[model samples]
Target: MDTTLVIRAKDVHMEFPVKNGPSVVALERINLEVPKGQLTALIGPDGAGKTTFMRLLCGLLDKTSGELDVLGLDVEAHSQEVQNLLSYMPQKFGLYEDLSVAENMNLYADLHGIPMGERPERFQKLLEMTGLSEFTSRLAGKLSGGMKQKLGLACTLVRSPDLLILDEPTVGVDPLSRRELWAILKHLVHDEHLSVFVSTAYMDEAAMCEKVYIMNHGRFLGQGTPAELSAIASGRCFEVKPLPGVAMRVLQSFLLADSRITDAVPSNGAVRFITTEPNLEIAWLVKQGMTPVPVEERLEDSFMILLKDDEQELAASSLVIFADSETETAVEIEESQVPKSDTDMPQLDYLHLTGQTIADDAPIDIEVENLVKQFGDFTAVANTSFQVRQGEVFGLLGPNGAGKTTTFRMLCGLLPSTSGVLNVAGVNLRHARTQARANIGYVAQKFSLYDTLTVYENLRFFGGAYGLYGDALERRIYEIMDEFGLTDKKDEDTSQLPGGYKQRLSMAAGLIHCPKILFLDEPTSGIDPLARRNFWQQITRLSAQGTTIIITTHFMDEAEYCDRFMIQDKGRLLILGSPADIREQVQLPKADMNEIFIEIVERARDKGAM
Candidate 1:
């Protein structure tokens, strides 16, 4: 009932009937209030009701119970009015592919009824702000992922709505692009006093918000600023640095073996664990007969501690209910009915390479010399050169439109280089495109698999296209399906699969041919962290078997998995070395790869690299 609140929800509940009986609650007793002209972030893992809440706020979905209001209007009763003052950018914004950037802007301007006199200036400013001026004539479909996101943001801002709802706006955007988007958002808030509500999986972005609502399984668990929420673990955290080559899984097991441990999570190079008793301190080093070093808690540690507390409380309540059963005849299920292990599950190995050995003398898998790709007068990639040694995990790291994909496409023979020497498996890809392509595997940035096809059928078609047939194809397909944990869902239509499974299927299809080298173009884009870890495991295993990998990723953590990399900016190579080397060059003490990447890109821009 606060007068300054632009969005107010009270005991909101949304449910959908399922087959057989009970309705699935997508939102349960959710209550929230957003003050005017403030940035509020909704943070959670996948299937956490973030999207459901956003849809409800935009009046795209109706609440099953309770009241919801936005901009002083009832969401359900004054839906039209609410819609007029709110702008929504769904995860998959409906951007027209065939239209040029300028044409797309014009179409949105018309749809929003933007005044003609103000259109030019507004469009020009947006273009300049988003760095899309040069790409105005390019088709929206041809734009890079980050550029497309910026365009979507620009289109949504055309009418200057009072409330902006962005669902995972920066999901796959590069750090530089994300920072730019944040800057523009700050400007909008400061200059126009606009209220912003955005949903994101990135914790870093959540930290930037004035307030954050943490949701899980359609329920609001907590709400507060970053510092306030992080204070939940104020005195209960401990950091442990394991010896070299000590797997996180092993460390996690060691922590969980102790009843005193409340939660454990891997961060950076250490494992942060929280204890049940805040005053309890265990010198793990002393217990293990080793030296100990002082450690500190992080925001992630606090979040995990809170999550674990919720889980334990739920488990305890369930146990009490079972103990109070009315039927005397009912056999006491005891602990047998409960899961023997933690239901929260252990984190998967993001990078796991088995004893699969690489041939020492295998030929250079990929070789590029002075590669140049130009679109009219603009050079997308200029004088780029690199080589992927046999069994190596190579990476192309760059900001949006820094020509990473262009270079990748040229290597894959999807695009002919304007000028330069390129070879894949020692064959000139430009001249022997088909032959070179036959020896390589590729997964594009977007979901490239057919939507209507079932998982099995998609794999079948891709396998056949790669020249696999009969028992060999069938055997390979099943092996891959099992390997990627898609065996049971093979009959399910691909489009019906979750975002993570779709990514897994894409990876399986790409590897069906068992090519000597694999090219992954942002292969983990839009997938959750757990799925990304699984995908990386597959990649690392392939690499260990001498299947060279050329990966492009915006996730800096993923970049750490690469053995060597080339960092590019505006079609020029900025740093080319090992991940450790790049980190060292950045020289930001205690900075992770993401921070280092941001600093490098900004520094380069200031030096006129962009």
Candidate 2:
């Protein structure tokens, strides 16, 4: 291995015993060389051996077979030495809620046995770098999600190790924090010459790395610099504008069902697709009364093409995806049912199941007037007002601690408003909390399922709590199992299921009663692109069925799927409108949601409103 390589691997194979079944292979003959003083990324979906590889590199999980080296030391023999020379930040970094940020930083320093004389300089540098200096006195639990992640990073870097390994560090964080965290990593790599290796589901994050390794089913699918890999998608990528009278999702689902297209997803109000036959596809697009536009190849596009093994079923076309979404079942339509003209496009079999909501006459399902929530002297949500129409996919977005979750909880009937009028499913939340809850299905930020329980048992518990009984509960449980493609995992412990399957089961439990309205809090957080896509497809299907969906997400691109969305900060509404409305308000009508969100939030901060 080259002396400059920070870590090297050869023929790495990892497997875990599965009790009653054969051993499960986590990694297979993996080979990788991470360069020093640079950023390297491992990209993969859940159960793609990413976490397994990370653990092996850290010597936390012994490999079945492989040669692994970290900083020129054998990880197996000098695990302590390797661990001492590097920092590892897992998805869940333990931060003591009772301790302040400064206390947490000191705790890590003590754990690493840093010299007392050196503590001051290291803590100051880390605090300034993570922008947590001002919040040092704040308890870890009091910090927002983004701030907590920053504190965690600061703590991890207390010893200033030569290398840093992060597994999805930015998961569930807002765009602003994500950008800031990357800045810290880039600063460390370029200025301090620290080697940073990370695993992330975000393609944009991977594109920033100097080297990216795409993995799936425990094997390397592809590896290269971002630009080098992006070149693979050249000429295979193109965009098609939605035909008149056709919903973007309708066209996307239609395209996803076609085997001719390799991948198709909604972006910036149009459908971006990959196909081997670009010219033929363009001609086909034109004949469909849509304009085909050539687009630049992106790392994400190439990534999908490489990890085609865990490929989303073409039958699982999604209405929206943070990265990708595919659930098990497909809503089938007869070939003859396909519309012959662009104007007749909106009428489809799926649309019939969820009567097309393009109409403006849909009844208002959620109405909040001057909604306010306060704790002693602090206002978590103040004077926030919004309305969601029947079948509308409404997005609630904010920076960490921005009160979107507070508003969501109010609407879900979990938290009683301190004051103000709140109505859900035509029931005044203040007067009929239980009735409102009965009509609403809520999926919390942290999935509210018992990990020790099997999928079947968890469903039964959630259903029974909702008053489902006997054959009604049994039939609904099986139906939901089939709906989310979880029938095979019914008896499996929830903890043993893959991240994606757990997400499906969580959603199933929420919708067991087929509630009139569904509330999802950061539903797509920490999952892979494939799972995100599948989750959104289900949301899309439900919305089409006249199910009002109220969701909060840190993924800005998902705003496209929402009919309307609201952004709040400092417990106040900063912006409220559709994607177009937001872009127009930010004077970036053509910009994506991330840009719009950053602009709005920063502008609010600048105005001292936040």
Candidate 3:
């Protein structure tokens, strides 16, 4: 073992056995070295064996074959010693909801056998660093999504382990909290000389690390500095904008469907795309009356191109794509057609609507007037108002305790407002709550389905609760199962399914009733890039068929899919506009959604808006 290397793996392979068949290979030929006192990032698409590798390093799972070394010790042979020198934080961080923030930290400190004499100094520093000094006595359950994440990090840092393994620590956190978390990690590396290994799905976070290892199918595809990997697409990236009077959505659709284009995504009133044909010239876009400009490549540009190339290579080799199970197949969907349902329903007619047809004149589907919600002396939301039009995808954004979810619950009829005019689909919720709720579907942030029940059983129960019975319920269940590609796994227990499959099942249950409006809360929080793409494709199809969608998410990039977005802070509405409009309104020329969000929120705070 090299003295400078904190962790090393040589020809490592991991496999799980089946009942009566071949073993499943999760990781193979994994060779890597992490330098001491530096930050290393491990990233991959969903189900790419990221968590498995983390588990192996933490000694929670025994490796089937190969050698693993942590701090110059064999992990398998000295598992107990290895575990004592490191900390691991899983996706769903374990926090005692009933205990106060201070109590939770004290418990972890005791578990690590920290001296009581040094506790005060360490606790003070951590509390100040994580901005939780003011909430020490607050119960963990009362903290917001971002606060709980910060507390979890504090607990893991109690002993100052030699190595820290964090698995998606910022999955459901807001942009501001994420920025703070990264700041803390950077400080630790520079001041304390801590060696950190973290896995994340966000490309921006991965770019900030000193070294990044891209993992797929249990193998490392690329390993280098951020700049080294970004050079992969140095000359192939271009920014294209629509001609005068042409809509950005129209141009985005054309580019995404073009065979020459590898990946096209909407960003700031333009489409950023990479080409399969390296020799394509700028004159081609000019001839088509579109403005094209050369732009600097970012980490995401390289990641998308690399993943697409890998998929094509796998197809040519006749190897199974990702997984051999039917559940992993990418379902191709048509944008022009509505979902074929047995019941009579109207579609949104997206293929036929032009820019003028989708303007503010469209019929209003949701209305909020002077909405206010209070608990004791605390005001969660105050005097907020917004409207969403029919067949539109609307996004609600805010900081962790900025009242985004509270507003969402009121719109879904799960919580009532103190005093306001809350209406959905022309029905006032205060007077006709049942009638208004009957037309909306909801997917909660956390998993809310039955764990022991099979996929089919869960779906059938939800369908029946929505008023379907007998053959109708059965037919609807089968239709949704087929639509989401869940038919073959209907007999599998919901808790045992993969993370991606569980997400699909949750979505299937929400759409069983075919409500006029859909409410989604952080629907794609921790899934891989491919799963997120598939999820948005389904949302686009539903919008084309006239389903109004109101969603709240922490992933800033997903805001590109919203027709309009509203940002709130301290229960006050701050900004509401299109992605392009928000940037232009804030006077930031070429910033992405994440930067724009930070700037707006900071500006508001400096001016006492929060």
Candidate 4:
């Protein structure tokens, strides 16, 4: 290995034993080298062995074979020496809920043995760099999703190490916080010459790194600069707007079903697809009055092609991915039923079996008027007013600890408001809490499920708790299992399932009683792109069937799908409108929702509203 390299790997292999099954190979003969003081990225989906490699480099796990080196020390031979030279931040939250932010930082600094004379200066620098100076006295548990991630990073860097390894540090953070976090990393790399190796699911984040290693199934498919990797998709990437009457999702699903199309997604009222079929002739799409338009390649486009190629090879070799058990059982609607013409685009009855309707004159499902919540003289939500019509998808946006979750709890009947009116399904949540609770469902961000219980048992328990019994409960459980693509994993323990499957089961349990309204708090956080897409597809279908949805997410791109969205900061409603309306209010042309969000939040802060 070159002396200039900060990290090096040679033919590394890692395997884990599975009960009564073949050993799982997390890494296979991997070879890589990272030059000193460079920011590198490992990009892949879930179950791609990214965490395995990180653990190996941190000396937390010994490799089954091959050599691993970090900061010129063999990880296995001199584990302590290597560990002392690097800082590793895992995916989970690493802060103490009971301690204040400043307390947490002081604790980490002391653990690193920083001298008392220098501790104050070091902690101040970290807090300022991470933009957490003002919230030093706030408890860790009250911080927003993104702020927590920033605090985690600050804690990891208590003392400058030779290397910094982060495992998906920005998993569920909002766009504004994400940009700020990356700016911190870029600043450290240039000013202090810090070496960083981070794993991420966001393609945009990977593009910022000097070099990116594309990993899949525990092996490096390719490694190169962002521009060089993007060249692989030249002339092969294109976008096609949906026909006059077609929905973006309808077109996306249609394209994805074709064998030639490797990947497809709905983006900004159009469909972006990657395919080897150069001619781009789809008889079905053509008959439906659509044309594909050529577009420039992106890092994400090339990365998807590589993953799809690897997946095809695995299928050809008869190798199964145990983590994706539900892939084969996913159901797709037929083309004829997917709106071939304007007249054919009828309202999809997703809950026809249960007989739900979304009338044009449907009454408001949720009504919050001048809502206020206070905790010991600290006002969490102040004078908030909103209304959600039946079958509408409403998005709630705000910075961490901005009262978004607080308002969500009040609307769901979990918390009593200190003042003002709150109603759900025509029942005042503060008055008739029982009736309001029965008409709605809730899915927490962390996925609250019985880890030790089988999938069916959890569903049965939830259904029974909802007052269902006998064959009715049995039928509802069966329906949810089949609808959520969980029939194959009926007996699988909740904890053993993958992130996507676990999310599906969580949603199934919530919907077991056919609630008219659903409250989702950061429901799609930390899941891969494919899983997020599937989850939204289910939400779209349900919304069409008269299920009013109230969702809060850090992902700004998802806001475009909602009928209306509201942004709050410091317990005050800052903006409320449709996606386009919000963009127009921000006065930014050609800006995505993320950029719009950043502009709005910054403007609010500038006006002393934050």
Of the candidates shown, which would achieve the greatest TM-score relative to the real structure? 2
Comparing 1 and 4 on TM-score, the stronger one: 4
For model 3, name the residue pairs that clash. Answer: 347-545, 348-545, 348-546
Model 1: ten consecutive residues of lowest lDDT: 323-332
Q: TM per model? A: 0.80, 0.94, 0.92, 0.89
- Residue 222, model 3: lDDT of 86
After superposition, the stretches of candidate 3 with alpha carbons farther than 4 Å from their true spots are 243-250, 279-288, 312-357
Let me know the TM-score candidate 3 reaches against the reference structure. Answer: 0.92
Candidate 3 yields a Cα-based lDDT of 0.82
Pairs in steric clash, model 4? 144-400
Shift in Å, residue 378, candidate 1: 4.0
Alpha-carbon local distance difference test for all models: 0.75, 0.83, 0.82, 0.81
**Predicted candidate 1 versus true structure: per-residue lDDT over 432-465, tens digit per residue:** 9999988888888887899899999999999999
Q: Over the stretch 35-86, how does candidate 4's per-residue lDDT look in tens digits?
A: 9998999997677889999999999999999988899989999999988889
Instruction: Tell me the deviation in Å of residue 468 in model 3.
Output: 1.3
The residue-level lDDT of candidate 1 at 158 comes to 82
Off by over 4 Å in 2: 282-284, 309-326, 330-335, 338-357
**Candidates 1 and 2 compared by TM-score, better number:** 2
Q: Could you give the candidate ranking by lDDT, starting with the highest?
A: 2, 3, 4, 1
Off by over 4 Å in 4: 240-247, 258-260, 278-292, 312-325, 328-331, 338-360
